[model samples]
Target: MTLLELLDYASVFVFALTGALVASRAQLDIVGFAFVAALTATGGGTVRDVILDRNPVFWVAEPGFIAVAVAASAVVFFSAHLLESRLRVLTWLDALALAVAVPAGTGVAMTLGHGAAVVLLMGVATGCLGGLMRDVVCNEVPLVLKQGELYVTAAFAGAAAALVAAQVMPQGAALLVCAAVTLVLRAGSLLFGWQLPVYRSRPPRR
Candidate 1:
């Protein structure tokens, strides 16, 4: 497989793991776990492909993607307790996912001759939407909606950087740099509790 395709598979694996982790925490059954895992693993990429008008979504073209997700869910189902304390795995995995997915999404868009704006937006959708689905399925406030560290914002920033860098550097190098930037920024946000300020509305007339 090409480097970008490899990165896409890696991102899918991490997303699958994250979905299984959440489902295990919720004490979901096997079917539910697999459902959530598959959704979280492919939802963002599916959306990105649709937005970019890329026919034949990745998972549809490659049944192996779904197989990997299902396998990941099975692994988590049986060994979840062993991974509880390392639940922080999700945060790190999220960082890696952002790194791999945003660049892959942007690369695909660029390859399709899309403008930079469209490419960047595709990258953001690719990186964030799966996690959004996962959070909603788990009944948690989505990270993008919360007063958490710049999640989607960070992904957009990295994607933009990648798209710009592609002008000068080789595709692989540009992708690596952008992914590294994303990983560093996101991991720092998690480690430092970095969060964007929230705007709260006061109650009106009593």
Candidate 2:
């Protein structure tokens, strides 16, 4: 497969793995695990495709992607006891999936003649929304909404980089640059607790 194609499949698998991991952490049953895994694997890309009017969506068209999601959920369901800590692994997998997906989403959107705003939106959705859904379904606060580190912001930053680089470089180079930026920004946030400001509530009026 070509590099972009490879990255796309890798993103799918990593996302599936992380999704299943989250479900496992929640002590979900087999069907629940599968539901979460499939949702987390395809939710973001489905949203992007729907918005961009892309046909059939990726997972719907690719049976292998569904197989991968099912297999990932199965593994997690049966092997949860083997994991020493699910959260750490899920976080790392999420970072890796975002690095793979941000550029792919932006590049695909731009290739289809989407404007910069649309490209950025697609990239952010592709990079973060699946994990956000996973967290929510697992009864954890979505990371993007938490007063923690800059999660979705990193996706936006990388999408901005891709939007600019695609204007100068070829699609491949732009994808690489965007992916690199996303990886660096996200990993830094995780490692350093680099959070965006959380608005504080005002005091009660008299």
Candidate 3:
């Protein structure tokens, strides 16, 4: 399996797990779990493929991705109750998914001979869109747009890191740097409360 494919699978499974957990929290049934899981798992990558005009979208090319998402949903459907803090687990797992996914998108753009701008945008889209879809579908606050969160910023930074590292290293190593930087930034936001400054709309002129 190529690195991009591997990253796709990894991110799909992880993102699916987060989706299932969300479904559980929403008290949804097994079918609902599967639907949400599959959506969250493939949403971002599907968008990436579509935008790049890749003939068959990743999951459409290989249905195994959908199966993997269903399997993840099944696992969480039966076990979500054991965790006292499903939200915490879901957050970290989403962070992991983001990290893996960003590299997948970046690698694809690079392989297709795209410039840095496309590569960077693809990376951010692949990492953030899945979770955004998941949250919106589940009627939860989209973490991507949460106040001052590092989610999108982290993906942008990670993609930038990969672009720079690609000049001095192999594709595989550059992607690893991408994942590491993404995970660290996202984890810091979740664990250490790292935040960006938010806009405050003050009353116009006194």
Candidate 4:
């Protein structure tokens, strides 16, 4: 299989794992596990595909994606208690998944001859929207909405790096660079609490 395809599947599995983790935390049943897993796994890619005018969507065209998500849900379902902190694992895993998904999305856009703007936007969407959907459905504040977190910024950096590197390297090399940049920045954020500065408005004519 191609590296891009492998990245896609890996993203699906990791995102689905996060979804299942959230479901377990919510005390949801097996059915809910499956539902959340599948939704979080495919939601971002589906949105990206739609925006890019790729018909049939990804999961619809490839049922194996859904199968992978289901398998992830099952794995988490049976093994959640083994982890010391599901929430911490979910956060880190989601970051890793974003590292993969951003390149997958950017590569697709690059292959389609899209401009850098579209490539960057698609990468951020693919990296972030799934987790956003998962958190919203779970009634939790989405990480992207949180102050100071570098989630979307990491995605943008990766996507932009991929697009720039594609001008001088093979697509696979570009994807690797993308994933590396994303992983490093995201891991740094987690490890050292790195964050963007928040905006604070001054009082109006006090």
Candidate 2, residues 1-206: lDDT per residue as tens digits?
66655666777788888888887777778988888888888888888888888898877777787888888889878887897888888888889899888877887798888888888998998888888888887888776665667778888999899878878988888888888989898899899988776666986578
lDDT of each: 0.82, 0.82, 0.94, 0.91
At residue 164, candidate 3 shows an lDDT of 100
Candidate 1: where is the Cα deviation over 4 Å? Answer: 195-206
Better of 3 and 4 by lDDT: 3
- Please give, for residues 59-107, the per-residue lDDT of candidate 3 as tens digits: 9899999999999999999998899899889988999999999999999
- Each candidate structure's TM-score, on Cα atoms with residue i matched to residue i, is 0.90, 0.90, 0.96, 0.96
Candidate 3 — worst ten consecutive residues by lDDT sum? 197-206
Ranking by TM-score: 3, 4, 1, 2
Top-scoring candidate (lDDT): 3
CA RMSD of all predictions: 3.1, 2.8, 1.9, 2.0
Which residue pairs collide in model 4, if any?
A: none
lDDT of 4 by residue, 17-86 (tens): 9999999999999889999999999988989999999888877888999999999999999999999999
Q: Backbone collision count in every prediction? A: 0, 0, 0, 0
